[model samples]
Each structure stands twice: as structure tokens, then as C-alpha cells.
Target: MTDEPALDSARKPVPAGTPDADSAAAPWWTRAVVYQVYPRSFADSDGDGVGDLGGIRAKLGYLAELGVDAVWLSPVYPSPQHDNGYDIRDYQDIDPVFGSLAEFDALLAEAHERGIKIVMDLVVNHTSDEHDWFQESRSSRTNPRRDWYWWRPAAADGGPPNGWRSAFSGPAWTLDGATGEYYLHLFARQQPDLNWENAEVRRAVYAMMNWWLDRGVDGFRMDVINFIAKRVELVDGPRPSVDGGSPMGPQIHDYLQEMHREVFAGRGGEHLTVGEMPGVSVSDAVLFTDPARAEVDMIFQFEHVSLDQGEHKFHALPLSLPALKKSLSRWQDGLADTGWNSLYLNNHDQPRLVSRFGNDSEYRYESATLWALVLHLHRGTPYIYQGEEIGMTNVRFDSIDDYRDIESLNHFREAVQEFDRSPAAVLAGVHTMGRDNARTPMQWDASDNAGFTSGTPWIAANPNFPGINTVADRAGERSIFRFYQRLIALRHESPVVALGAFSMLEPEHEQLYAFTRTLGDETLLVVANASDAPLVGPLPVDVTGGDLVLGNYAGADGSGLRPWEARLYRL
Candidate 1:
């Protein structure tokens, strides 16, 4: 792979610190903060151990109070519970575990009534094998719907067509004994990839999207959307990897443009479409999110998050603050003139932000708010994952049996049985890097099961919930939740925070994360000590005469930054 150019590389540049003239008429989401709700872990109104639509509806008041502009719900569609509802069996209906379609509508109505938009998780790239569409296609090789999915003949040696590996740790292709062909699944064997090359498939996906739009949903958080278009020729590779096949294929842009024209055209600028692109480069992201291209409002690029990741998600590496800064700065510089950005540090698929990047032990509150300040001040639409606002942390289960995520389970089996790694060592990795670290039940109160459910939860709540739950945070004078509320409000009120040009202050600073946001005559300086020890170096920028706008500590000043201290200055 070629290296991405430096920040000074030639590219189209928007005038520094000036908001786009058209931004005044742009969609509401340009400056909006979105909250992602993983349904299974959000709340369980039924007390049946799983969060449901009613649970989400019940929490609308809490979210509204938090001041987010939208709630992006993870998939709640009918499924066999494979991939935690991502393997959709039916696109138009709600799963029984999440409540019926009527309950979803009720949640939608309540969210809208609270002046919050509802963004649905659109998972169209793959479907559960139980889906009728896949069942029919796999019935026979000559079936009319056979082209709906990727079906390939066995190789000369009667093996699979490619050396692709599933994201969850096995072979990407599953051989169907009855059909004598192999079907591709980038994730799990149960989730077969769809053939975007099929015109009928594209049309069907667009139709389903339109159906959701007609039902009054605000937009979509597309799942691994960049994987939809595969290379025409499926060649054998060295071995299976996390990303099974080629991504961001030639026709990806075409498919997105077609989708926009068919599903969202003339629908006004109210809808927000953000594609989750796993392997997208800055250049490709520019083309994907450029307003004139009409492909998507913004795209989720993974460069920054992958800095600490090694060969796979579980193999952790030391995080370099300089490298992280370079990666983020590159994206800011690349998209300054053309595309928009979606800034986030935590999500359903990632471990807790504070645990992964901050001190989640003694300095939990300070570090949590510090990271929140840094992320929200960037020039992008920020996304807040569920439970992150209250400083929720990763779970530490004693045994692998306590985990539920398919990816973690598969990794454990492969590492211990196949690779001859020690079981304890593998479990330690899972404790630190597993997806289930983020999948623990949301901590609402200090009650049993963290008040997530009256019955035993599907997944155990983080044991630290008593001190980190929402109720406690909301009551504390100095809490992460309160800090998040102020940050959200600042984004809504200050144009400089939302649309300003970003400039890094100290690109190679080891302990300090400093940046400036500029818009017209207004400039804001953000400084944070991302370490547990006190920062005693020269300040990156002079804040001598600037007005202190927001800070985590009560007596924070320009003298010196305390441990995990974050401050915003209006200059």
C-alpha cells in the first residue's frame, strides 16, 4: 500500500476558518451530534434480559436532556440473533426480541416529538442464511434468484473459490452440499454477502431504503457499506484475513450515486446518510463524501482507530500519540475543502474510549471528559456511543464463557486450539480488546444489573457501574455526563466549534493534545494533558488574554495543566 502524503501535500483548500456560504442552508445534521444506541445493551423494558424498542422510547427524555440531535439505533430487524441483529432476516419488520414494528414506530414518533432525529442502522450488504431471499437462491444452481448472492463453483481441487477469511475468524466461503457451490460471507457463515453486481439486488436494496424513509426514519448508518462492491474476478490470495476480499471496488461510487438518486433524491436535505467504511483512504473518502457527488453526507474512516491495532483487532500495539495526531490531521487536511467528517472514538464495535485511550482507573472522569472535549472540537459531526457519556468502561469477565460476541469467541478458539497460544493469554487479549468489552449492558442506575433489566441481563453489566452509572454521574457536581452535555451544547451554539478549520498545535507532543479551531474572527484554543502525571512544559499556545470558556478543573489556568486537565479558551 502507498503512503498517504503529509499534511502539506497539494490539495484543494477551503479558505481557512471560514464557514461555507451554503452551510447556512445545509442540512441540520452538518453540526449535529449523533448518539448511537446498541439496542441489546441500551435498556430492557421487558425485563427479559434484552433491550427493546420500548426501552429506547422510555429513555428519549434522558437523551433529549443530553442534547443530541439524533439517535442512531443499531439493527433491530428480525433475525436469528447472529451478529447481534446485523444478519437481518427481514428488512421491513422489527425482531420479536426488540419488539414489533408498532413499537419501533412508537419509538420513532417519540424521538421526533422530542426534536431528535432517528437514524436506522442499514445492514444490506449481507443477510442471514435464514433469510428467504438467501434460502431461495441457495436452493438450486439454476434458481432464478441464484444471482442475488455471490455463488462460485469449486476450484479444480474441489476446494473453495478463494482464500478469503471471514472477519469472525473462519473461511469466508461456506460450501453448500446441496447446491455443490460456495457462497461468500465476509463476516460469519450465517451472513452471506449480497451480489451488488446484480441490478435486481441493487433495486431491491434501494426499494427497502425508500420504504424505511417513507416510514419517517430520518436517515441511515450503513454497515460496512464499502464492502458491497467486490472485484469482478475473485482471485486466490495468500491467506484469509479480517477483510476477506477487495474493498472499495470500482463500482462503489456508482452504486452509491444510484442509491442516492433512487432513494433520497428530491427528499429534501433532511436525511443524513453516513457510510461506515472500514478501509477507505483519504482520497477515496473525499470522492465519497463530496457534497456535489451526492454519495453520502459523510463517511466513517478508520485510520485513527487502527493506529493501536496490529495484525487484527485482538493483537494490540502501543499507541503513538504522534501517529494518532498525524492520522487525524491528514483527514482534516484532506477533507477541508470537499468532504465532511464523522468524528468518534467509541462505537458498538470498539472497546470503551476511556479504557482504550485514557486512564479508566484513578483518572476516569478527568480523562473521559478530556477525550470528549478533543473529539467534539474537531470539524465534523460527532457521534456518541451508548453509555460513553457517563464514563462507562470495558467489562472484565473472569471466563470466556461470559462473552457473547461471535468475533471474540471465534478468536479464542483459533488462538488456543489452532495457534497453540495459552488460553489465559488469549483471554487476557479478549479482556483488553474484545468487541464484548463494548457490548456490556448499559449502566443506568446502581441497582441490580445496573438497572438495565430486572432479570439477569443477556450480558453482565460492568462491575464498576455503581459509581459510573448515569444516575450517579448526573448527580455529581463534576461528572463526565455533565461535561458531555456542555460539549454538545457548545457544538449547537458555536459555529466555530462545528464548522471551523482545524490546526494542530503540537504535532509531536507526547503528553499534550493541543489544537485550535478558527472561524472568521473567532478562534478557540483547546489544550489537554492526556496523561496521568502533571504537564510542566511550555504551553503550546499563549492563552494569557483569552477568556476561559470551558475546563474540567475548577481552578485551571494558564500557569500549568494538571493531570488529565482539558480546557477551552476563547481568544
Candidate 2:
């Protein structure tokens, strides 16, 4: 197959208002708004300075009041904290820092009782080096768990087997003295990739998944689930695009399909499973979520997130509204028929959308509402990150030493060593795109630690606490939190916005973005001015009579929109 640039390739254009080729087939995610909770930053109830299940349980009402259907916890499982919680130590047990099994069970019960489903973070690609299984695997060649992780013999030149590089920089292999061999890791050295070819490993993962389901947990928000499988032939990938290479390898789908057949199939038809498959294209994603095989319920695509990154691939760039819209349209159209899209802007990995997409000046609130209007009022199951409703911004780190995310630190070092990028530039890039953007303590109020902890938090809170927080927003009728509540409630209550067919109206206009969702006879037209400057554009379609439902600008009536304003109308 030819290596085509993802954005340049032409795809079949999916027409506007066309029903999802199979919308009639029991739409499970039609009215669901997934509330993404980075368990570590959600709320810390134990005063251990770390957020946990107990903290999440204490805030269930807040989520319920926000009108979300489910909570997508980032990862609360036991880990060595190599990649925050992405490196799993145990598939079944909750980390002691977070809480115990009993607390997790109680959390599920409370969430379900409040009509909110709980989806766990499934990090199946790798295991923590400290995990008993990995420890045993590396103990010796003859160990029973030796095949649980990928191990390779040294090359004839006395170097690593392959030229594979880690996502966090450096070689993908780490030397294990016990076996005199190197173990493969796509990410950090402490996170050794699991051998999916091993049937025992597959069985263990499936059993843990079933255990969680049986315990009344709703579904799983799989973390790097696609990485569970790798190209079997183990061929060297292409030359590094930058100094380090592209992180994606080949043949990962085979393992994913087998995993689905053995594990996901038996979880009943209603269970949800969304994969965090970054760098995957529309055609590539089809293989994982094809209706026939059903490997996963949905997949999170990174196209939209790429908008903030500099074109050179290593630096931060100012966000452009046109670029943002163009990227969003691709996913909106690409996945319209084949599979479901896990729509999101701010997650545990990326910076806050309000800070990145919205103007950070005095127009913050208006820009935030504009972003919400643009993201939620579209096709796919929207995932709103915690503290996003209150317009959370990115955390400002003073130095590289102040950062906790391994990826951010690794990139900073690379920028300095390889690219000669200044320390300030590196820190600025980290501020704009670092994981700490989502890792900041949840801003509950202006109180100490932003009401996230009774004591000091593990990470510093974003500086804009006085103007942006849940307490202050909830107190005011015209606040970002209230706007989110209205937006989520509107999606839930109206079929036009939830289950209706999506149609993009104006594609050429830069300032004006218009789309209509039609459900049988009822039609809801969502129009927004994505720019800070006021815009006036032609509405070619006829809407003879309609009532205005919602708008972000003050003077918005039935006909026009102001700067950074949006409106939803029913006709």
C-alpha cells in the first residue's frame, strides 16, 4: 500500500442530512454525553493530595446536574505512574493511591443509582515494569510468564533487535539483565508492551474486563487499546519523520479483532467500548469498529487535536478557526457511516479547549460558549472533560522540573538537545499542549486548592480561579457552567440535536458555521459565529417560522448572531 499523507488523500464526500447509513440500527449513543473524569485531577477526598474513586463518588451529583449520561474515568488502576496511569500494573485492581476495590464498587453503585454509567479506562497495550507478571517475565527465560511481554534477542551488531522508538523518545527496547534480553515498550521504558500473541495474556485481560462488567460498571473507556496488537512480522518502520520516528507500527488490527471475539462479544449488546487510537485514519479505524466484527463501540480520533500543533510537528502554533473547522469536518464526515466517533476536545492528554480554542482575553466566556456550541452541536457522542464546563484553562508550569507528565518532560528535553529550542519555548509548548492542562486540580471554587483538596494538591491549579470555577459559575445564571448545563440538557431533551440526521449548511464562509439536524418533521438549526468579530452571512435555506432556543450573544434574536455568539433554533 502507498503511504499517503492523511490529510491530502481524497475520500468519498458524505452528503449533508444523509442519515448515518445505518442510523435505524439501535443508536445506543444517541442522547449520551460522556463526562470525562481524569480521576487524578477530579477531586481528592482523602487529603492524600491525589484524586480517587472516593472523590469521584462525592461529586456524582455534580456530574448528574451537568446532565451527562456517563463518566469516562481516565485510569484508576494500579500503576507505577510511569505515564501517569497509562502504564498499568494490574488489570483488575485499583491503585492504593486512588482507593481499594470496595471503593470502586461503591462508586459504580452510586453512579448507576444517579442514572450515570461508569466506564473504566482500559490500558491494554502495556504493563508496568513493577507488575508481578512483567517481573516474572523478566526474571529468566524459563519463567512461566516469560512470553507475557515482548522480548527479543540482541542483534548481531550487539544492539537492540529493531530501530523502533518510544512515543516518549529514545529506543523502544529496554535491557533486562535477568534474561540478558531486551523488552519492547512503545512508550516509556517502565511500560513494557504486552505480548498479545500469548493466549494466556489475552485470557487474563478478558477475565478482568468481565469482572468489571459483572460488578455493574457500565463499560470501558479504553486507553491506547489499539496498541494491544502490533505488526506480527516485526519489520522496521519508516525513517523517523523528525529526529525520532512515527510511533505507529504495523499489523495491530489482528490482535484487536481476536480480542473482540474472545472478550468484547460476551459483554452484552448494550455495553460501550471506546478506544484511544491516536494517529489512526478513517479507513484504518473502520477495521477496528466494523459492525460485523465489533472490536469496539467507538474510537477517539486525534485530527481535531492536531489543529493546535505547529505544522513543523514539534512546535506550538496559534489556533486558526478555519483549520479547526476543516479538521472537525473531516471526522464528522469520515466516520458518519462506518463507525461511531468519541467526540472530544479537552481530555487527559490535551490542553483545555476553552484555553486553546477560545480567546484567553476578556472574551473568555463568550469564546468558551462558542467552543461548546461548535463541539457539542455536531454528530457523534461528545466527551466533556472535567472542569471544562467552567472554562478551565491550561496550567502554567514555571520549569520542566515542575511538570509531572513523562511525555511533556521527554519532549522538552528533546526540543532542547536536538532542535536547539529555547527552554522558554519548550515550556510554552508544554503549557499549550501538555498533559498538565488536564491534570490541573479541578477548580471547584476560589477556596484553597480550588476546593479540590482539603490540603495542598499534587499539582498546582490554573491561575484563573477567581473568574472561572464551578461555584462562581453555578452562582451566576449567565455563566459557562450554566451554558454547558443548557447545552447538555438541550441535546438530551431534543431529538433534533441528538438522534436527528446532521447536515452542514455553509462550508465556505469563514466566520459563520451552520448545520441542521432533522428528526422526521422536527428540525433544529445550529448556527455559530466562531470568530471574535461579528459576522453576517446568507442563510440560503428557508426557515419561514421557528423559535429561538439558545444563543451566546446578548442581542441575538431569531435572525442574526453577534461576535463569538451561537444560537439554536427549532423550525
- Number of the top-ranking candidate, with TM-score as the measure: 1
Highest lDDT, which number?
1
lDDT of 1: 0.87
Looking at candidate 2, what is the lDDT of residue 252? 65
Which ranges in model 1 have alpha carbons more than 4 Å from their true place?
1-16, 19-23, 235-245
Global Cα lDDT for candidate 2: 0.76
* Candidate 2 residue runs with Cα over 4 Å from true position: 1-24, 235-254, 311-314, 417-419, 537-544, 557-560
lDDT string, candidate 1, 56-167, tens digits: 9999999999999999999999999979999999998999999998888888888899999999999988999999999999999889999999998877767778777788
Task: List per-prediction Cα lDDT, in the order shown.
Answer: 0.87, 0.76
TM-score, cand. 2 vs. native? 0.91
**Model 2 poorest 10 in a row by lDDT:** 1-10
State the displacement of the C-alpha of residue 177, model 2, in Å, after optimal TM-score superposition.
Answer: 3.0
Candidate 2: deviation at residue 468, Å?
Answer: 1.4
Give per-candidate clash totals. Answer: 0, 2
